[model samples]
Target: MSHDPSGHPAHLGRPGHSGHPGRPARIADVAALAGVSIGTASKALNDTGQLRTETRARVKAAAEQLGFVGDARARALSSGRSYTVGMVTTDSFGRFTMPVLLGAEDALSAGEVMVLVADTRDDHVREAHYLRSLVSRGVDGIIVTGRSADARPPIEVPVPVPVVYALTPSTSDADVSVTLDDAAGAAAAATHVLGLGRRRVAVVTGPVTARSAELRAAGARSVLGDRMTGEPLFGDWSERWGRRAVDQLDRTHGRVDAVVCGNDQIARGVCDRLRETGRSVPADVAVTGYDDWDVVALASRPPLTTVDMRLDELGRIAGRSLLELVAGGRPASTAVTPTLVVRESTAGA
Candidate 1:
């Protein structure tokens, strides 16, 4: 017996069996069990047309009993379509793409489609590799998600399939695109603060290069007009940035009556800092955040008021768009609007 490097019994290279006992239970076994011809079995297993219900049932039952899964590779080779869809994301998956991905996956699952996810870590070379890999894998469609609008996607590879871009700005090369209406969301946030009778509102946001951020700022400006005070404090979407930004706001501008955070994480940080400084939420200074992630909003001392980006909806729409494109439908783009979730962070009156 051969031992693996870890001293475990090696499962490979064994005598008589070549370490593996059975050929991955082929269609032949299914056919034999079903008492059907190989061609009939193949058709039944692939769900091709024109088979009687009873015949299809027997073939399916036999294949299931034998643990026979049709070869995806063979199907792709014969049909010229790979049933897989590829989702390519930038390196910062945890911060931004998590909700978007979840939404996309949920939508795809409902459509009986499988998604193959790849991470580029924001590297152009890696992005290119993954794009090529998806094409080589024979994926029927693709979804490219960028961290921000400023992301210059890597060179496009010609593939015999449709590609959808999500959460990124429109690309000349894409068939469909979907993103949040950041300006509307930001305006909503500003309106929430103004409704609370706040005249001076500060903003803590991520890099200005992010299109979503820029749009949000613009929206806030539209509502607040010249009453919006202080320069936007820029930082990454982290609690640390939130804390520091709040500290800076306090030092520079004194007690601002309202704050609109770039995201939930930053909002939480700002809220924490406000509590530490003995400021009463909504009473002393109202706070609002974007990306109304429930856990973060509800867990705060006073539940946070936030803008719901409707990430799941974004995903479903994108998935539907991609599926439509894959089915030879026309190219399309969708802009999902965000809604405000009112909580203790903002005053109702």
Candidate 2:
């Protein structure tokens, strides 16, 4: 076993298998092995260095030989900083939310910060409870994720740490926010149909209360102008809604040449209904959707062309913002630009 200048056995490779009963080496053991004071060893290992270079190296060498891993909990407690961040999200856990969480985790992990997560299921009481619990736990920062910008988070209590909101607009004064550019995404969809020479355009959207749906509708109307006909159909975020919207479109506007759906699911429903009614896609009618769900788009009869909201980028930005707040930086907000992904669905054949 390699020993530093001191007599303590350096159990580098050889397990301290022999009789000297390898009492788990502690800071004292490292100090003794390095022939340095315990305080010096602690400071050197923690990088709180006031110690000489030679002393720091010797202490580090001793720790390496002993396979010492510092206890983060103990360090945190002693320093009065938990080094943890709390992430509070809506209960739905949709595919969109997953990427956002991944981005936040990646950023926090890179900074050596720990994260604790909670889901509120959009329940007001549960949201309050989770927020209070996080504050009580001494988390250094918080990230609140909501389903949309119009969501009203129920956290009424004041938080002691910095808080950042992602994929949602902040209703509170303390939070820094990041959100998707929904109006732009929707307008792009409408403009695409117009470019294809489709004079009659209609919208099939999710529940009116959903901020994304509202913004998308606004964008569509802005591009289509007064000549655009038919009342916007509103329904749940499901394939059934998509199918029903198509039937409604046919009933109300027999000459409809294009439709913009709230999401890929709705677009798929519209496509199925259109084919059943004997309409040739893009040849007779072009359809567009949002969320760019690859599986559905790839498998569709003509494949679906949808908007990619850049969800992964949204997550990455949210994560970066939270870290900045935790590092004593001012709260900052960001808006993610949506991209249009053209596929076979809307291609004129």
Candidate 3:
């Protein structure tokens, strides 16, 4: 370490820094404060290899006192790399995106990589702008996420960075994605109902326009076959819809033995409606739901038998996939299957 004009210790902290009052701290300020050349400060900040461990530590400490943020733009220009990942999502509320983004961030953090996330609210223009900005910033990769089991358009940026779509797939086969096995989840629900020896079955679920609802309905249909009664009783993703659907099934199908619900809220409603009509769950009727939302499932009259999407694991896999791509591995698509969490709702007494 070198001394200043007064021969005072240069790496102490604020005392070593000199600047116009309230002026923003700069790299030069960090170097002066750390008793190092600008080149050493840059190396320490960027984590460049072959740096002296003690010198780097001293420089970092000075930078903290100065509140200096390394110039990412300058580093990117000089090294042609930015050890950062950008995660884009429409779900700012994080619902589906949280677990996936956290998984990716945690995995990347262990490798000294950082993640920058943006919420586009599914806006086309905003999505384009964020992609362009992240590309220009030289992010190593990106992860795109949407609300449900569906497909969206690919990121239109021309940059070389890899983008992994999570929850929602990309319509482009060239782009990689990680999603749940929707069909398998529905099949499991239907099978559980059938396994309880309930031959007469019906479907109760959300809107017809939702791809998730359609796929789940198809999965249940494939399992129920001749045993499935009536068309899928489509309604909103709510308890009211579930209760109304039960009434509709009772009117048309007369004596249904079981029902597969699209979500726990609907399943809970169905159970309430069945009891109102003097039907005992699992004895007179067995009901199963998807997306084992514990708060709703566990609070049901009889604890619900539901499918666990394992979203955190899906997020982890998605993170792993993006890291693999960043490390020069071939981009490959993957599908994660959900699990069945059995409870009293489908348990035959």
lDDT of each: 0.78, 0.79, 0.84
In candidate 1, how many Å is residue 296 off? 5.3
| Residue-wise C-alpha lDDT for candidate 2, range 14-102, written one tens digit per residue | 33321135655677777766777889999999889677888898888888777677677788889777888888888465777777788
Choose the strongest candidate by lDDT. Answer: 3
Q: How close is candidate 3 to the true structure, as a TM-score?
A: 0.80
- Clashing pairs in model 2? none
Segments of candidate 2 deviating more than 4 angstroms = 1-7, 11-25
lDDT of 1 by residue, 1-349 (tens): 3345332223322333222357665777667667788999888988897899999999887766656766878877897877778988884666467777888888888877788999888778887788888888888888878667553543487655677777774556445678788989989999888877899899888777777777788888888886688877778878788788888997897769899988887888888888898887878888888887777878876788999988778877888888888888885687889999898888552
Ranking by TM-score: 2, 3, 1
Against the correct fold, how does model 2 do in TM-score?
Answer: 0.87
Q: Candidate 3 regions off by >4 Å?
A: 1-7, 10-79
Q: Model 1: what TM-score?
A: 0.80
- The regions of model 1 sitting more than 4 angstroms off are 1-21, 46-54, 173-175, 226-255, 276-278, 293-301, 347-349
